[model samples]
Every structure is written in C-alpha cells, then in structure tokens.
Target chain A: MTSHPPAGTPSGIVLEHVTKRFGRTEVLTDISAVLPPGRIYGLLGANGVGKTTLMSLVCNHTFRSGGTVLIDGEDPAENPVVLGRTCFIREDQPYNDAFKVRDVLSAVSWFYPDWDAALAERLADRFHLPHRTTCKKLSRGQRSALAIVISLASRAAYTFLDEPYLGLDPSARGIFYDELLLAYSEHPRTIVMSTHLIDEAAGLLEEVLVLHEGRIVLRADADEARTSAFVARGLDSAVTALVGHREVLSERRLGSILSVTVRGARTADDESRARAANIALEAASLQELVAAIGIGGIGGVDTESFTTQRTSR
Target chain B: MTYARRSLRLYLANRSYVTLIPGGILVIMLAMSLVIGVAIGMATEFPLSAQIQEGMRENNGGAVYSIPGFLISLGALAVNRNFAMALAFGSTRRHFWLGTLMGFGLTSGATAASAVVLLALEKATNHWFFGVYAFDVAALGKGDYVLTFASVFVLAVLSLALGALFGTAYRAFGTKGALLTGLAAAVLVVAVTLLSASNKEIVGSWLGALGVWAAVVVAAIAAAISIAGSYAANRLARL
Candidate 1:
C-alpha cells in the first residue's frame, strides 16, 4: 500500500553540514551524520542541546536554515514519497483537541500505508488508554501512551521518537520497551529515539549520537561508547598525579575524594598505578559520557580549564 | 491512499463537524424562519396567502448565512488544529494544501447543492405552500436556482479561505500575530468600504455594469489569493 517503493539501495539519513537557526540563535550547527537503515540509533543530549531540533530537521518537520538533509538519498521537504516513509512524533505532539483517543488512532492509520490497526488496539488495551476520551482530557501518561501507539504502529521506514517516555511509569515504560523491541524485530525499521533516561534506553540503542551545543560531539557504537571514556575515583592529589595532564571530560568532588571521568580507555600501566594509589578505574556508562560531554565541553572546547575550575571548587 | 487523499481523510475525520453540524444548523435556521413567517402571516390583517406572499417579497431570510459562517469557523479550526498533526504524521506541505483545497471544494459544493435543492423545493411548493420564503430570500438569488447555487458556493469558498488565512497567521506567528492580521483585514475592509462610499457614483456605475458574475469572479480571486497566502504561512510555521 506504500505510495512509493522502498529504496533499492537505501543510504538511510545522510545529513551534511546541516544547520538550524531560530532568529539570531543557531540551534544546530554543522551537524553531519549518516544514519544507515535498519538500526536503532540513540540521539543522546542534554536539554536544549539540539537533539529534538536535529530530529525535526531530518524529518523536514521544520525547514533547515542551511545544509543538505537527505533521507534515502532524497530531499524530504514537501516530497510525499519521502515523507510517506518517515514519521517524527514530538514530545508534546499536538492532537486535535476535539479528537478522541480512538479518533486520533483512526485518523493516523489512514496516513501510514503499513499502519497496524490490530497492534494499535492491543497497545491501547495494554496501556489502559480510554478509547473514548478526548485527547485534551487525557492525562500526560495517557498522552504518552497514545504517542507510543502511533509511533510503533506506523511501521514507517524511518521513525523519530523525541522523548517518547515523558510521563510513563516504570511498568508502562517496560511495556513500551517490550512492544518497541517486538515491533522492531518483526518489521526492522530505522528508529532514532532521543531520551534523557540514557541508561534505561541504553540497551535498545545500537549506535549513539551525543549532541553538545548544537554539535555532535560524540558518535560511536553503543558498546564502543561505553568504553570511550573511563571514570577514576580516588583522592584529588593521587588521581591528578597519576592522570598526568590527560583529557578530563568531567570531575566531581565530595569533600576530599575526587571522581573524574577522563577520555580514552584506561591503559594497563594506568590501571596498575590506579590500583597502587587506591584509585578505582571503571568504564564510563553512556549516561555519564553524555553528561560529561555536555558539562565539560567537547568538540575542541577548553575542557582543561573547565576541569581545573570544577576540581578547585 | 495518495498523500492528498490521506490529508482529505484527515480533514474529514470528524464527520460531525464537517457535514452534520452545518446541515443541522441550516435545518434549524429554516425551521425558525418558517415559524417567524407563520407568526407574521397570522398577525396580518390581509388574507393569509396575500399577506404571506407580500411578507416574503418584502423580507429576505438571514438563515442561510449560518452555513457559510459555520464553514468559516471549521476552516480556521482545521488549520489551527490539524496542520501540525498532519506534518508529524508525514504529510508533505503540498499534499496538505491539495487535500485541504479538495476538502473545501467538497464542503462548499455540497452545501451549495443543498441550498439549490431547498430553493427548488421552496419554489415548487410556492414558498412552503404559503410563501414562507425560507430559501426564496432575495439574497439567495430570489429563487433563481443557478444564481443561488453559484452565490452560495462562492461565499462558502470565500469564508473557508478567509478562515484558513487567519489560522495560518496564527500558526506562522503567535496570538498577537493572528490578532494583528485580523485587525489589518478589518481595517482593509473598512477602508475599501469607505473609499467605495466616497466614490459611490463611479464605483456604483462600475459595479452595476459588471453585474453578478463580476462579484463572483472577485470573490473567487480573493479566495485564490487567500489560499496562496495560507500556503506561504504554512511554510513559515514551525512545529
């Protein structure tokens, strides 16, 4: 039922020096990345770091201020063939206030050629979403559930989920994850999800793209990202002396002890020295790496001075 | 379905608002007009038939205006509420615009056709058997079915286009922007009216010479302009 056939050789999303600006402020600057098809990519970033903006630009929901965005080697702007294969649901996705939950689902079903009505019904029941309630009257959690229903059921070739778990509880989030996995396993589409709950969603992500100040500071495989940096914890003097001017991503002090996240894997020699100095060296989690990149400034920013000032404080 | 057809479905999703409500309003207005006409006939001193005919000839019905008015509000709501949803769901701007135009055409055409049918019925029944004059009002082409259909159709299109323009203004800008646009439209209308009044002799002669079709042509042109403006506004709108 798709209006256009799937690309014979899908290049996926190829963004080259994409930029977005709001008035005088640049939201996304020189963002370039190639998201190949059929993999789940995690768009990780701190708030206002352009995670949502980047997704919006790629979806052509908002026009890019500059640069070229190609989904499946085609400009998506006003292209029905391209857009039909894409779906990007915002965190606060607006629905017609007058539409009931069922109405929203039914209306969206018509747009997506691969819309799974049976799955939509199952998800609604599992989420306990009141079918007859108007969208405006639905609670935040209910609204999020409705969004999830739309996103997964759409079966779009490229789907963007921006903070799709805004108000779901732990159990509900578990259901969402299970349903997402099941859907992905069955349909195998490209899913780019942006979330602040990094560790919770870390398992689902195959690749990670960390955005900092409208730029992608870190892009790596989920497994590679975990080992991109290491956290060393010990007394400030011992940790600093052993570290010896290495790149520090972030550092925090609790009275006398210092726990610093430094870029690059822990060397064998460094590990031995850390053991002798009572400094515990551990791999940095995806969440910590993103936080450090956001807080300590990556992308050639002065992390040395930032680390020094924070350590001294 | 094609994107345009999908968008049309989106616009027509709420059948109650698009079709039922407007039809219901028209029916209610017609009923009210009938009641008013009957009461006036009973109060007259002349014979009922003559008085009813004389009344019908003298007074034009305002009921039909509700159809276009309802359509105008519906058009505004469609843009205000559905545009973002449409984009999020993967509808291209071009498809949305095309589908919206189709929806507008269908709605207006259906309403105009209904009005023409009612006009025919009124004439066939001699204005509801007693010249009650519900659909036979002077503003609705004075029982001329073709003119009445054309006039109502044009008015409906104009109303929908105006509403869509306002909605687009609201989306591209915020509340203040929409309000300013509305004020600007009001000012323009007032200015045109004032100018026309000042040069009534010249303007009147031009209008009189052009006849009814000229008004329809002008309205159609205005609707086209508004549709274009809406497309531009939609492009500028974010989220």
Candidate 2:
C-alpha cells in the first residue's frame, strides 16, 4: 500500500581461489569471483559444474579443500553467528517424514532467532500444504515449497537457494518468483540462486555469475551483460563490412540473413553504418550470453571486427 | 530445542524403515518357541518323563540357547535401524541409542512377560527338575521364590542388555556392522556353551545362579551407560 523504501544496499560477496574436493574427485577448482550483494544473483552453470559445491563452501555446509570465501567479511565455517545469519535450503533437506508440516515449522522456528512464524504459515497456505499431512506424504513440489517457506521466513541475512525449482512447473515457478520478489522488496537480504532454466528465470535475476567447469566464466550486471553483446543480422557481405576485427562469440546463418553474437559494445559509427546497411541488431539476452560464454567463453572464440552491433528491438 | 527432545521427535517421525519387520520377527520367534516345544513333545512320543529329560539337556539346552539368541537378534541392527530416524530430527548419536533401546525395551517387556507367565504356569504342574518342588518356589518362606523370580528378572534384564549392547555398537555400522554382530554372537554362544559344559552344575546354589544373573545384569547396565556417554561426548565434538 505505502511506497516501498529502497532495498538495503549490501555490498558484494568475495570468493578467493576457493577450491573444494570430495576425497580424490575435485568438485571445484580455483573458483574466484566478486559478487555484489543487495541485487538478486543468478549462479548459472550446468549440473555438476561446481555451482552447488561453491555455494556449499560459501554457506559452510561442507569444508573446502583449499582457498577462502568471505561473506561480506569474515569466514563462515563453524561461526554460529555467521551460520545463524545464513539460510541455505538444501535440495533434499533432511527431515523426518513422520513429522507433520507444523512440527517442522515449529522446530525450524527455534533454529533461527529471527524466524517469522507468521510468514512461514502464510507461505505454507500459499503453497497449499496441509498442516496435517506429514512431510513423507507431501509431494516433491510441496517439499520444495516448504523449503522456500523456511528460507524466506528465517529472514537470514544471507540466503542461498540451490536450484530451488527443479521439479516445479512454470506456473508454480511463477508463484515462487512472485513471492520471492515480494519478500525481497520487503526485506532485502542477499540471495544467491543457482538454476538450470536460465532463459525462464532471466527476468528475475539482477546480476549473473556464469561458471564453466568450476571457474567463473563471466560476472556482471544482467542487463549490462546482455547489452555488452549483440547479434547483428544483414547480408553476410554487408554485415562483414561493418564488423572488422572484434571477438566473435558465435555466428549462425539463417538463409541470407547473417546473425552473429559479437563481444564489445556498439559504437556510434558502428550503429550508423548498420542503419546505412539496413541491418538489424538484437541485444543478447542473459541466456544467450551465458550460452555463448558457456560454450567457449575465453578460449576458441573467433575474432572479427564487430561495428554493426546495435539493438534493433 | 534440546538435542534429546529433537532426537525423540525425529525418532517418532522416521518412516524410511518399518518397525513392523522386527516386530513380525518377534511374533515368529514366539511361535517358533511354541512349535519347538511341540516338536519336543511329539518326537519324544509325548511321554512326560522323556520330555522332561530332553528339556534339561536336548541340543545343549535348547531353552537356554533361545534366551541369548532372541536377545541378540532383537537388540541388534533390527533395533539399531530405528535410530536412523533420529538423524532427521538432528539427533545426536547418544540420544539415538537411548531412544532405540527404549523402543525395543517396550516390545521386549511385553514378549518376556507373556513367556514368563506361560513358563510359570507350566512349572506349576510339570515338575521337570528333580527335587525342585514347585510348591517350594511358591512357599516364599526360604526365599527360593525370590531367588527364582529374581533369576527371571536377571535373565530378562541381561537379555535386553545384550540386545542394547549390539544395537549401540551397531548403530553407526551400517550393513557390514550387522555381519560383524552375527559373528560376534556366534562366538559368544560357543564360549558360553563350552564354559557351561566344562562346569556341569553351573547353578551351584539357587542364590549363586541369581548372583551370576545379577552380575551380568549390572555389567550390561554399566556398559550401556559407558557407550551412550561416550557417544554424547563424541557427537558434541563432530563427525
């Protein structure tokens, strides 16, 4: 009803050469990145790409093989103060199936000093979880909803959602996204969400951190990341004339219209030349940029001058 | 919530495994005991005298073998598996053993009570042991009744202790732990049998038999205390 006050401005989370290994198999290797806080963070990576492992180290769920991770400031391992301030909803959170929803709610309430019981119940109702139904009987989606409820209700200073919507349908996901944004607007806590559905969730994330094979391939503002890359389409000769020697991420020819994702921003001259050549330039979505970076971010990229790169839409 | 309370709750909610499995085995055990009792009757031609003779010495004391075997099987992983439920509630390992024992203890009490009642009724009429008068046990004057009842109490207690011993030691041991438990049980059986055979009148005096039983009961209780206490300290420390 009232005008929303600006969300609390939180700085960034820094990971310094953080590496984690489980026995002999190395899950993550030399992962270092600085993620600005306050804004929603989308940790984009394929499955087994070390997104979950990195998040675990960040939350101190498991020990790291090497390196350090800082949450705003200070280490998180065994520090009750830090752990209490964090809410990490594991994919398959261990809970007794015989326990009714209400029991789990009450138990978790005690774990978090700032836990909001009212918020938890409200979210439970929103997700249609019957208080009488024990956790074992609850559907997988219901389990995830319960997890979402706990994480949001905890109001933990740092919240990590690791693929929170794996089995959720689009409509259910829409509800989750809406509730998440609403909650974030009301209480601005640091949120790091890892997901495989990059395109579907593109609109919800404010920033992006792309991890490829246990390393941060790209990190920047979601919009800026999209804007910084574009696909210019026109006659191959005409488009080639505009683009000389810039880094070309990828190019695909659909009949005569040539579309190529090029790195670097579009200059004024390049825009005019594209307009003169009657070419169309479309801004790359976060999904496209991620796909391009994920495929071959820094290595094996073809280099060409990109002058006609401009958003036509 | 306190760790104990949380563990109790977790134990209550755990359903990945069913308690019914061990419970069903318990029913089968009781039936087996009765069936074996009948087979003893038929094979011995239902002659009361031969049956009595066979009861005291058949198969290295069949009734005695039943006592330890039942306790070991009941107290082993069949009971320990229930502890896994406690982990869901974030229960410490110490509480896990306690809760599991408490659960199996209740079941053990019911079965033992029924068995004792049946045995008492049988002993009232059938005087199997020579010179051991049934009325003497009932007299309660020379403390013979106390001695016998106490033996029953000690047996029940020691059997349960043996069970809890296996359960606690096997709690962290997964499936492999069960195999180790079986091997240990077999070895204990052999040792007890050999010792009893070497020393014929194992029951020197009724009071002495009760004393040995009492000692075993006390030792079992002490071991349970030590194991559970150590588990608490270790859990507080870490994995």
Please identify model 2 stretches exceeding 4 Å from their true place.
Answer: A1-14, A22-25, A34-39, A70-74, A78-81, A92-107, A130-140, A299-313, B1-8, B12-239
Indicate which candidate wins on lDDT: 1
- Residue A182, model 1: lDDT of 98
Off by over 4 Å in 1: A1-8, A299-313, B45-52, B187-206, B209-214
Q: TM-score for every candidate vs. truth?
A: 0.91, 0.62
Could you list the CA RMSD of all candidates, in the order they appear?
Answer: 4.2, 9.3
What fraction of native interface contacts does model 1 preserve?
0.92
Please compute DockQ, using alpha carbons, for every candidate against the native two-chain complex. 0.85, 0.09
Model 2: lDDT of residue A169: 70
The whole-model C-alpha lDDT of candidate 1 against the native structure comes to 0.83
Clashing pairs in 2: A11-A37, A243-A305, A244-A305, A245-A304, A245-A305, A246-A304, A246-A305
TM-score of chain A of 1: 0.92
Per-residue lDDT tens digits of candidate 1, residues B1-239? Answer: 37889888888888667756655676787788778777876886322577557666557556446776788788888887888889999998778867887888887887788788777887787777666777777666677788788877887888888888888888889788789878987887798889999999998888788786666676777788778878887777767
lDDT per residue for candidate 2 within A53-120, as digits (tens), equals: 78767766556889877665656564544555677777766555456888778766655667888888
